[model samples]
Target chain A: MSYKDKKVITIGVVRDLTGLSERQIRYYEERKLIFPERTPGGSRKYSFADVELLVEIANKIEDGVQTHEIRKEMLRAQKKQNQEDVRRKMIQGQLNAQFGLRKGPTS
Target chain B: MSYKDKKVITIGVVRDLTGLSERQIRYYEERKLIFPERTPGGSRKYSFADVELLVEIANKIEDGVQTHEIRKEMLRAQKKQNQEDVRRKMIQGQLNAQFGLRKGPTS
Candidate 1:
């Protein structure tokens, strides 16, 4: 599907995808955990990314991690992953250099 | 240091490691988010795993995931990761089979 036309899932859809109850999802919204866009009729619409994030949040909770703590951990993990991605790109660049496709010593 | 004697950290230590206030950590415990071991003197003793979990929980909260929701999301993420790891192992096994290092015909 085109990016803009990609389905904007309803709250029920998000609940099903994340295996969370409607009440729980609403409660999370109230806590500013997720801010799904609202339709003109005031219906919540979630994106696929939102559903994935909800799943991640659910996993942390099942591990007995606290909500606030989970927030911090998610941010840290995201940052760490970003850094790792950059490092991987650097390594790939080095590999390319070995084939004389790029010019640079390993960083 | 040996595992057992590696040091059972105090609540203060946990707070420092998790960047959470003592009250917040205690609140999480009351909510059954985390259950650190207790000392004979009724002091809370956190393990390294507890610290790591706390860090993860903190990340979720910062990401705007709710407490109860975070619990569910964390659980789901953990299951997903476990499943992914198993899938990766299976793929690895298939690769090994291609080299006659395993006894399977690509299941």
Candidate 2:
């Protein structure tokens, strides 16, 4: 899955979309939850994906999960998902190697 | 989607499993994060799901999401998920009504 997005949103836009205070947003960054881009002047510039992540983080916070804990779980879950992808790719590669598979070729 | 579970664990187990202090756990409950079942004497009895939720909450906290914000976001997310579920069920019911769907029936 691509984490990149085209639109670059400001912190204010994130506040509007996720209903989070600027302080909270910055604090979340301090905690390392979501990392938006930085302008040359050191202003925060968020992507669409960052917006979604803020929303998700807000949801988890509302659910009574602690700050540090959320980070750990998300990272763990992400790692697990990445591993699953790698595993699937490895299997696919093996299958192709054995069967002499090629793109757009089915017989 | 079943929130119910067997094996009711005590606070001690939750603490051990989640690496959360008792005070933090109780504080999380007061903040309305995880609501385990209460015994007649008012002791907490948690299910596996509750334990998992606590773990998740811890992860989020580690990730830098704030407390109240997390609660708000989680609630919003849950409401959205519930709405999606209702929408799906409504669609499925309509389709079944129109097509006379039956259990274990396939052509």
Q: Which has the greatest lDDT?
A: 2
Poorest lDDT segment (10 consecutive residues) of candidate 1 chain B: B1-10
Residue A97 shift from truth in candidate 2, angstroms? 20
lDDT of 1 by residue, A1-107 (tens): 43222225566646655789998878766765666876666777665667677777778778998778877776798899999999999998888778744445756
Q: lDDT per residue, candidate 2, B17-72, as tens digits?
A: 57899998899889988787765567676666777788888888999987787799
- All candidates: DockQ: 0.01, 0.01
lDDT of 1: 0.70
How large is the i-RMS for each model, in angstroms?
20.9, 18.4
Q: A1-107 in candidate 2: lDDT tens per residue?
A: 33235224456556765789999999999999987766556667665577778888888999998889999998999999999999999998998889965888577
Residue A37 error for model 2, in Å?
51
What TM-score results for chain B in every one of the models? 0.62, 0.82
Docking class of 2: incorrect
Q: Taking the tens digit of each residue's C-alpha lDDT, what string does model 1 give over B1-107?
A: 43222224566546655789999889777766777766555777665567677788888889988789877876798899999999999998888778645545856
